[model samples]
Target: MNGSDQTERPDGTAAILSTIGEVAYRWTREGDRLEWGGDALALFGIASAEAIATGHAFDTLLDDASPLARHDSLLIGADHGGGVPYQIEYALRPSGPRGPVLWIEDTGRWYADGGETARRAEGVMRVINERHAREQRLAFLSGYDDVTGLYNRSALLDILDQTICDAKERDVNAAFLLVAIDDFRLINDAYGYRAGDRVLAAVARRIRGRLRDGDIMGRFSGHKLGLVLMGCDENEMAFAAERFLAAVRDDVVATADGTVSITISVGGVAVPHDAGNREEAMERVQESLGVARDSGRGRFVGYSPSPERDAQRQTNITLSQQLIGALSEQRLRLAFQPVVDIHSRETVFHESLLRLAQPDGSIASAGQIVPLAERLGLSRLFDLAVLDRVLETLARHPDARLSLNVAPETAAGADWLAKFAKTVSQRPDIGSRLIVEITETSAIRNLDETAYFVSTVHDLGARLAIDDFGAGFTSFRNLRALRIDMVKIDGSFIATLPTSPDDQIFVRRLVELAQDLGIETVAEWVQDEETVALLSSWGVNRIQGHLSGAATLSPPWK
Candidate 1:
């Protein structure tokens, strides 16, 4: 028989054009529906031949709105002679048991007609689709918020500027509203940036729901966002902002640790209605934000567009800078909190705390320095300075196994991690004795990255502890995944640990959970002996509170 006439199924289970090639067959049934053979179905994860014959093949290949179904042109080959032919790539997304993708090369017409038939029927998978997918991912990483899936500050401004310029030329009115989360940082401080980011993501979703079709919103800064209301009037703008605020108020962001309550403070300016330029509009909204913060948190302050408010904004900026400068120049000092191991009734370690040393020879708590530092955008720097004090004290005593308090914002910073690694590198000996106490919210900022860092620290002989557990939604997934060495029950939880049966039950369960994971449990703010006894009974491995003593050094730690 001639080569084509040698009717053969070399493999009894299936057939291919060439004995060496993959399975290929065409079946027509169910009103001209076409079904591919085993090779194509297998690429999509189909296990058996009988499965494809049962209309599964039809269910897998075509989608509801497939353009392929509507197009009338025959699948054709290029005008290539019988030499090695070139082929363009295509992707096949399956909708059934096989999984998402399969690629088939259509190399047929090369031999069917005289060489002029073109190389139309060639089957070879190319990397084009994969390459395009990678580019899309890159674009998202560079322009989007990983948590919220919205545009970040950099991407937001670029889009805003383009929209604004286009609107100006077209004589269109586009309003810009700046929404700052009221007490959002407090949530972060109380919870962790990881949990805080979840809240932001939830808030972003709410804003998107409230926006118009042409309008866009982006996260402008940590806890601050911007919305562009295109083709809107003063009244529409008002309605949208109110709509956004109302939506946010309705949200309850849950983290693995706990549920966090939050609210937003917004300031808006209807461009062309209130200001002539972007800078003026942004400044006016900023002033309005200042008004919102000053009046009381959790409310909206509409832009008034006046000189007095602008002046006040400038003054605040100046004061913030001065405060930052003072701290940077040896104006911050160290205080120590003696945390006793409740069961042992002995001081195991003193938590290295921060104090802003004033020129008046008075020291203020870190709680005082944080707001100013944040306003100055120097929170990371302040956190590092605190680390320095902690490290320096360890250098003095060398025997103290101390845990250091950390702020959420600082933990999320690349610079902080870089410096943290450097500090450890400089004093390798200190690594074993240090307990880095990070709040659940802070550690959760970027969970995977933070977990890797935690693992790295553990490798370096440093311990990782989650501070303020039960204050936010932190999960056992993270607890298990990260392998944290310690869990600090939030002081609020400890404060009511005995009085509230729910609290006692939760703490006991938490302690047992930590034990199962080989993580120690620490109770914070244990004020009295009764609380200490309760914590001890609950299996708290350590305790730190006022009863142990206020954080101090020589001079009342003040």
Candidate 2:
């Protein structure tokens, strides 16, 4: 058919298609001619429809980077008895030279003759610039931080890992530096978070400007940027760190609110020499950064191996491996300590404490393993393990009530809650008998998050309590915000409640305050009747210590 014959369509249908940025076209393979039925001029941003009248003329509009030529994608496919269908997306620069590029989704079917060669194809093309832009943005954000436009933490770590491997193979030295913006929290506090983000972006630009072509930088964490410098030794790492420090320190960052001056602390480690892998390199660089900050702000510290630190690191590594093994082998056990009612002297609940079972028939207390787990970012594993065991115990003994303490990280996030929600869904009845305890220090660290955690636990039919309550000196406002069911007074105050007048006064006031807020107070480390009497007189709800009982591995209910 001729171009004019293929251009005919119902007036209303043609109008609707053109209104929606769609154009229908018929291509004749014999003469390489193209016919447009809709508003081809508007869709292609051309002065007239004749500009794209032929297939060869239309090919000129296809962007050079288009994945495949239109003829190759549509005409080259194998023929079926019926018409073969195809769909493809490509960019077209239809406007005059230097105009914006337009993305189009073309879909249609082609009919082939008896020779199995395509003769003609008819299709519709729709403008898809917005969709293509969104996909491109998501692809960019997968590896880049949108805030500072630097590689994100995951991408940075991947680069660091590869760099370490490359350095080992090349037998050349390299360096990794972690740069932290000192007192960054203060900036966010003084200005708004948006201003703080501007400061980060400015600092990133400054550091990026100073980086060598071979070096790489990324947003490692909040207020911290990681750098990988190639062919650099320990001494060169120090020089690089100082240059970065000056890049951020020499000038002030201008935000919408005002100009703010900031300094950076840098920690550097020579790769393949001081650190054998990414994890080791990160650990040593972090330690170095800590030293720089400790010495003073706006300084750089190169990681130096110390006998004491090395021994401590080795011990931590061994302990972490053992902890992981214990978790996997089911050797991490829980010990129960009873919290007794002050007036009735009956058991209120048993607090579950974690204990490690050594292979040689020895036991390790939570005090020995918990702090290390928290430092090594393994507390969530322990939290989940303890949660599973607690649920199982509660399921076995239908009437047992147990309280379990979680690490600060667990309390701040929803991972533990997600685990609890899954198990509670199966054994919904066990939730009421479970009490989740968060340390006072952790609870107050982020009051809003803690309050949300407490609210969620209560919603799931479990009670929430603040453990080591008096230690953090939680204010009345924060306590009310948490809305916790109970508070366990810090053991330090209860251990000397009978002998120390100051402790007596503190404990008394704390108990009275908790009572006023409708919160039950439990005093810990009660060793004598005198202290119990004192606590009882002050209306303490419960007591847990030597006077009540010590935590034992054996189940109390059995």
Candidate 3:
């Protein structure tokens, strides 16, 4: 009754025997007491378990006159040296004459090498069980998403590939739909990120409830969702997409903030029976997504390749290469807009805006350079360049103050702080002169990353400001958390301020909030002299826009 007995194995050899042949008993085999299992002795009508071995009191059971006695010899011959594990189809004689000759299990083991072999066999069994358990876990994870227990992207791909193969073999029609969330960023911005995640889970559940038993759905990408619609046509797929959107609109996600509902934009393509492969099918669907996104938000578009769109995409690629050259060749420069002190009517900081110098000696403004750069995934490169140029200029112009315009995408991306640190380390004095400006559109979607980034940069002797403030859903809360150095009232709020009393009041309240938080404020898009005069009276610390006289770099803030 050591650990061995408790472990189901008896005597550190065979596994513990439970009930067998109705009557319960502990069965075991040993070289000396070969019948210690004892169940067999009772079945064979032996007077004693030991007598079976001695051939004395149970002699009749094996004697020539007794058929039962003959059967004992057969059992011994078939077992003993014949091997305990031997399988025989022959008859087994029963005891008491009434018990007919039964064809029995004949299952058990005898060891010539003692229990040493049994111990090794048990260890092998344990290893096999462990390996099998590990394999099952890996198999489950391969098909299931760890986050929400839906199928993962890889699983979806596998399902699509297998379904296509099956459809092809059977000469049947099959298709797939890829649904992408159009405004996931807006939802994430207005609600907390935790709320956004629950929305995704809720969307997944609603989709599942609507879909048939065989249909498969999963989160295709972060912020972009997708579904696989198979055994259907183009028209059938379109109908499913509409149903999916309707389901999502009806489903409300419960979170700490409350219940919130959202919508999705679907793009899909039918798998052609003769299409080259899965990649081609995916490309078709992705093309549809681009069309849906372009047409408007919360809509579905079917796959139809356009040559003009292809050419536009190619042009984008070409422009990206040209821009890279411009960056390296020092062909990019900054244009400045003066940020005037409201009460004193004197400039305090000149925001350094990016402008690319064309080979023909023409300067492309921030509107032209930044929008294109952000689209080409060069937002970080462009922002880092702007910061570097500002630092270099400040070294020579010590008396000059600095503010730099950064695209919203630059702050949302992962490469922000790493790039910022490199620039800051190179120019320590430039820190006080530099102010990093961000739009509400960019900050809203990726607030956590933005907060961490702004905090890190501000700690390193730089300033952070929310540009185009009050335009997005979460600007107020983000402003509180980011604790920025300044706020630039969006131009739209200012454009109508000269006539619209409501616009003027919004600006006043914003200024009051800034004062309470101990953060400065600026008014952007100050177009006319009248707007400038209005912003000044409304208590904006600085004004920047066309009224500041286009944009000049020679005198820095002409």
Candidate 4:
């Protein structure tokens, strides 16, 4: 087709195609001649259609890194009978220095001659700049935090894992720093969440600016950043931490709310030296950060291995392994403790406590196993195992009512609730007969999330209780918000209830408040009849202690 026949059609099809950012093209392989239709000059931002008249001239506009070229796509393929169809996405270089690079989706068919050599091709090219830009944005967000524009936690952990591997293979020292902005919550509370976010972004920028070229930085969590310093030993790590601390501390971040001075506490660990794996690295760095914060805010603490701490870690590791083995071997058991009415001394519901049997005929109680399980990230397994056993017990004993305590982590997560919902769906009768207890401390940690958890458990037809109630000193508003079925007063107050008048007053007031809110009160660790009498006089609903019965392996129903 000639230039006028290509660009000027009487039917106005060329005008319609150009409006939609599409252009038609034809190529003759013999003389490398190219022809374009539908306002090709405007669509491609070229001075004239003649600029791309030849195939060689058209190829000059393609990006150097583009995956495919026209000749490669048409000539490299096997010969077909009629025509071979193909589609490719590629970038086109700008015609001028100020022109924008365009992304094009080229789709067409190539025809072959009798000799099986490709000779001619015809195709339509559509601009896909918007779609390509959206895809590129999504790709960037996958590995980055939008707030700080830094690598996110997942990406940071992946890089840290590789760094650990490199340290072991190359025998090169590196350091991982877990940095937290000290008193960040104060900023959020005094200003607003938006101001707090501004501070976080500012702190991230400051820390990133101080890092070496080979180092990597990322947002590890809210108000915290993770940094990996290559070829850094303990001394160097400490020095690096100091530099970061000063970078944040010396500046006042300007936010929409106001200017706020910020300081950061850092915890550093020499990788493959103090920490051999990702988990160990994270754990040690967090421990050091905690120490730094505990000593004083805005300080740097480097991990130093100690015999006692090492021994404790080793013991924990051994215990975790044994616990895993015990769980697999079905040696994990539950002990039942009856929560009885204070006045009637009759059983209300039994609290199911976790127990693990040892090969030497001894048993490990929940107190021994739970904290360690939570620390070692085994609480989810324990929670699920306990839940299965509890469900089975409820199924077998129709008249038995049971309450079970879930770890703080489980209380904050959805997995336990999902399992409970599934089981209750299968055995509808068990839901009303079961109670889930979350510690008061855990409930107060994030009142909003705990309230949602309470609401979900109630919707699933199960009762929810706040365990160790007085320990958290939960506000009346939060207590009402949770809408729990019962509050078990912390054992510490009840342990010395009879002798301590202060404890007596506290217990009486707590019981009165719970009663006023229509929430049941259970006094734990009631040892003597005098204490029980006091609790009964105070109108405590239930009592669980040695006076009633210690948690026993033998099932009460059996």
Runs of candidate 2 exceeding 4 Å displacement: 1-176, 183-198, 204-240, 256-258, 271-283, 293-296, 423-428
Candidate 2 CA-lDDT value: 0.88
Give all TM-scores, in the order shown. Answer: 0.51, 0.66, 0.61, 0.70
Query: Which candidate, 1 or 3, would have the higher TM-score against the true structure?
Result: 3
Residue 119 error for model 1, in Å? 57
State the C-alpha lDDT per candidate.
0.69, 0.88, 0.67, 0.88
Please state the error at residue 98 of candidate 2 in Å. Answer: 13
Candidate 1 stretches greater than 4 Å from native? 1-273, 282-315, 371-376, 555-558
| Residues 493-558 of candidate 1: C-alpha lDDT, one tens digit per residue | 888766899888888888888888888888888888888888777678888888888887553221
Candidate 4, which ten residues in sequence have the lowest lDDT sum?
A: 1-10
Candidate 4 per-residue lDDT, tens place, 1-558, comes to 443345656777667777888987788887888877787777787776566888777777887667546568555575567777888888888575345789989898888865577788888888999999999999988999989999999999999999999999999999999999999999999999998999899888888889889999999999899999999999898789989988988878887899998888999999999999999999999999999999997899999888998899899889889889999999889999999998889999999999999889899999898888888999989999999999999999999999999877888888889989998999999999999999988999888889888999998888999999898898877888888889999999999888899998988999999999999999899899999888888888999999999999899996
lDDT against true structure, model 3: 0.67
Error of model 3, residue 519, in angstroms: 4.3
TM-score, candidate number 4:
0.70
Sorted on TM-score, best first, the list reads 4, 2, 3, 1
Clashes of each: 32, 0, 2, 0
Expressed as tens digits, the lDDT of each residue in 1-558 for candidate 3 is 121122233453323332323111222233212223314444444454455442223333322333443223323322233344422222333354454443332333333333333211001111122444576678988887755568878877777777777777887666677776657777788887776777777677777888876777866667555566667777687788888888877666676766766767778877664344678777878878888888886788887667897799899999999999999998888777788776675788888778888999888888888778878889888887876677778777878788777776667665656765776688777677778888877777777878877888787788888888878745465688887888888888887778998988788888888878888888888777787777666667888777665578675622
